[model samples]
Target: MSQSASQVYGAVQALTQSSDTLFLLLGAIMVFLMHSGFAFLELGTVRKKNQVNALVKILADFGVSAVAYFFIGYQIAYGNNFFVGAETLAQGNGYELVKFFFLLTFAAAIPAIVSGGIAERARFYPILIATFFTVGFVYPLFEGMIWNNNYGVQTWLETHFGYGFHDFAGSVVVHGVGGWIALVAVKYLGMRKGRVRAGKHTNFAPSNIPFLALGAWILCVGWFGFNVMSAQAINGISGLVAINSLMAMVGGILVSLFAGKNDPGFIHNGPLAGLVAICAGSDIMHPIGALITGGIAGAIFVYLFTYLQNKTKIDDVLGVWPLHGVCGAWGGIAAGIFGQTSLGGLGGVSLVVQVGGTVLGIVIAVLGSIVVYGVIEKCSGLRLSEEDEFNGADLSIHKISAINED
Candidate 1:
């Protein structure tokens, strides 16, 4: 090759690489902000006594996820080889850094999701440990199967079914996993003090509305990066994903407002429902399809939240299951319907395949969470003592109190 030609090629390659790096970095930054949203939202929902604990857990989860992803979780999730040694590390070198950022956000999510359930009473140290195991190992394993291009479950699905289970962003992988974990954690932790007394129930109002609203807005903003950047390409498709995400949020807002008789709590959760619902097919769905999908998700969130809170005794402080798990399922299924090429090159696979994938993802998530939480509870004890529960984990466990001293 001529010297000038070689130089030009090298320069172009460098530019492309730099551009890709920049996009990934931006996506990482946005995903990081989601932790803040989760923190503020959770703090708003729980009583003041648990505020500090919630904040600390949110911060600590990010740190734990970072360390775990760097050491082994990244490799386990995306590496070409699974053998433990220098050879495995060498084979996994190039992808480690990118996987670290991607999986760290994912790991952070698991703890964030579970935090709501154990709000008000659980010990801090144990919760931290659970976060470590969840993000470090459990969450990564599922993510590996879902997104890892080389040897993931997606690959198996493609080989066996002739069409891979699609999750353009991570409805089934991220939110679904988090929701199941929250369910198990809540079940194991039992109910918050006074939640059930002599067969009667107690109502717990949000401690701060402004905080919740701000958190919801933050989540809505971060979702742009979550859905659009998942495409990993900065072109027309990315723009489409961004539009879908926005539309979905708007749809969620409208649906929740109308469906719930203008309930503020439902309104706050509606945007999340839209985001989660659209995640499965955000990359491919048309703008209008996204609206419908998001609206349905919002409605589902209202229904599930009410059912769980009023009909059942599940004390899901932040409604993670309804917002993430159920909506994630809706998103995945919506992809199968709206992804039809007629809509925007979305649905083509048989309905049975789509349903199977959704069912399989949920089953795996639920069972995995059950086992992980059960083991953690047995080993370290998941909840605080009765006295500590009354005193609040923030004070009893962390030695810091949110209460003002006279």
Candidate 2:
């Protein structure tokens, strides 16, 4: 090639890299905004007295998560760190930095998910420590294995099952792991004070329906970035992923409307259930298949959440286990089913691998949650005192209430 041709080629390549960086930056921003959704969702779900604590914890957790991921978690998961010179980092149009920002949002989501389940009664500092260790160590372990293909786990799956595990956007990696991890924290922390007095479970209503609905909306809108931008490049973007996500969201809504008996809480959360379930297969599943996957997930969330609260007495505040944990696992398996050529999906997904990978994720999350939360409970304690609980987390922890009197 001539000198002019080389120059033109270099310019085009630079432009492509710049565009990709900007695209991913937008996606990172959207996913980052989803943290606010997590905050308000918890705030609206918990009792009025604990609303301020809910808002504070989510923001604090995000800040801690960024620090942990930057210093240790990102390198452990991807075998790269930011210890190099700024000039070296600026190469590749600083895409690596923005990519870190994108994945950091996903990493921070682990503690954000757990925050909902253990809301209202958890001690502030202990929970922050949990966030640090979780984002810094536990989440990155499985993340490395799945997304980064560390330890040849993906290779082993493909070798054994004729295809690798296919989680296009972290059904098991983010939502599954976060949801399952939240379960341990919830169970260990136990029910809130008076939550199960007289052998009867208390049915606490959401403090603000509009706030809850707003959270659901923000999450729903941001999910496009979560799913569609997993491709990580403009050239790799697909309308299929976007449409599948939309179909699944609608499916979750319609199913939850009927299954939840039109309860506003369930109705609002229904779309989240669908989106969680569709994350794994959005790239491969047809829109119709995504709908079915999401619909089932919606039903699962409503039914299991009720069972957990009433029968099992788990006291998971936001039903994170059913909505994210179980639904996310279902998504992993559904990807194998719905991504099959016979199901009107793009093939090359394996059921055996999907199930195996999902199970691995569960094991990692469960063990990690147990060890981290367990140690914390044994040492510094996890729950608030009965007096503190009665007074509410806002006044007890943050020294303020959600609503102030003039």
Candidate 3:
């Protein structure tokens, strides 16, 4: 090759490599902080009796996902194969590190999402076991199918339809997966003690709103990495992703502020709704499109949370389904609608296909988790005893009490 041509090639390669490395590092750090978000969010929602259990589950999830992702999750999700001929695992150097770090964030998110459903009642050891299977096998398998360039959903989409199923970020893959698991967990664990009785109603308010707000803020900040870094190429699109994410978040806040009739919980959940709504299309959406999408997401979350909690009686303590699952579906569909090549040269997909993919993801995640949790419940018992639950899982499972009457 000519010297000038070689120089251009070398420069392009270096820039690509640098972008990948920088985004990977930044994304990993941001995602790690989301654990703090989970901790405080769960702690704020559950009663004080279960505070320690919430803390332990969040901390353990971070640690467990780290180890599990390092050993197997990475290989399964981003590895070249299901079991063998995995190039990322072969040398364990170069781009492998980037892939590893990226997958770690995803793995960590799974258990954190489910913690909301099983809050205040599940046995600690069983929760840990569920996290193990989730990160180690279930998440990896689905993630690999969607993300791994050669052998998963991308390949399938390419072969069948000329364009691939584009997630831009991981609305269905990560958030959707986690939300489904949470639903299943709640079903298996049943409602908190005295939450429902002979068709009567009861109120279970959050223990601390400040903590919930703090967690929500952390999640909003970390989402920058979660969405922008997923570009996997951190040049122009990365900046666009960041802008879209912020726009959506702001829109969500504004919409919720108005829609909530000045309710703090609705306002606090707005940014989360926005974050979920933009995850699938952040890289592709115009600023206006993002803003609208986020605003709608925030409004929807406010309504859904009330509807689910009050009417349906699905006690999602942290509103994971509304914030993550429902808005995730919105984001996925928005990718198909608002996405435009003319805006930024990012081609849009068919709305039909996008909706199909989104629905498929939700169904699989919900049903799969239900089956898995059902088996676990039958085999080892998932819920704590009534006495233990009433007293609190913190003291029952960990032998630690949050109350100190002294």
Best by TM-score: 2
lDDT score, candidate 2, position 293: 96
Candidate 2, residues 185-264: lDDT per residue as tens digits?
99998887777878888889999989998899999999999999999999989999999999999999999999999899
* TM-score versus the correct structure, for each prediction: 0.92, 0.99, 0.89
Per residue, candidate 3 scores C-alpha lDDT tens digits across 1-406 of 9999999998988777766677677777888888898888888888888988898889988788877777777777665433445564444234556656766887789899889767888887777877887888777777777677535566666667666666878888888878877887877777777877778757588888898898888988888878877765556446788899999999999999999888877898898889888888887788888999899999889998877777765877778877887888888888878886664436756666677778877877777777678778888999889999888877898888876778
Q: After superposition, how far is residue 67 of candidate 2 from its true place, in Å?
A: 0.7
Better of 1 and 2 by TM-score: 2
Error of model 3, residue 5, in angstroms:
11
> Per-residue lDDT tens digits of candidate 1, residues 102-133?
55786678788778766887777777777777
Per-residue error for 356 in candidate 2, Å, reads 0.6
Report lDDT per candidate.
0.79, 0.95, 0.80
Residue 102 of model 2: what lDDT? 98
Worst 10 residues of 3 by lDDT: 88-97
Flag clash pairs in model 3: 145-153
Candidate 2 clashing pairs, residues 3+ apart or interchain: none
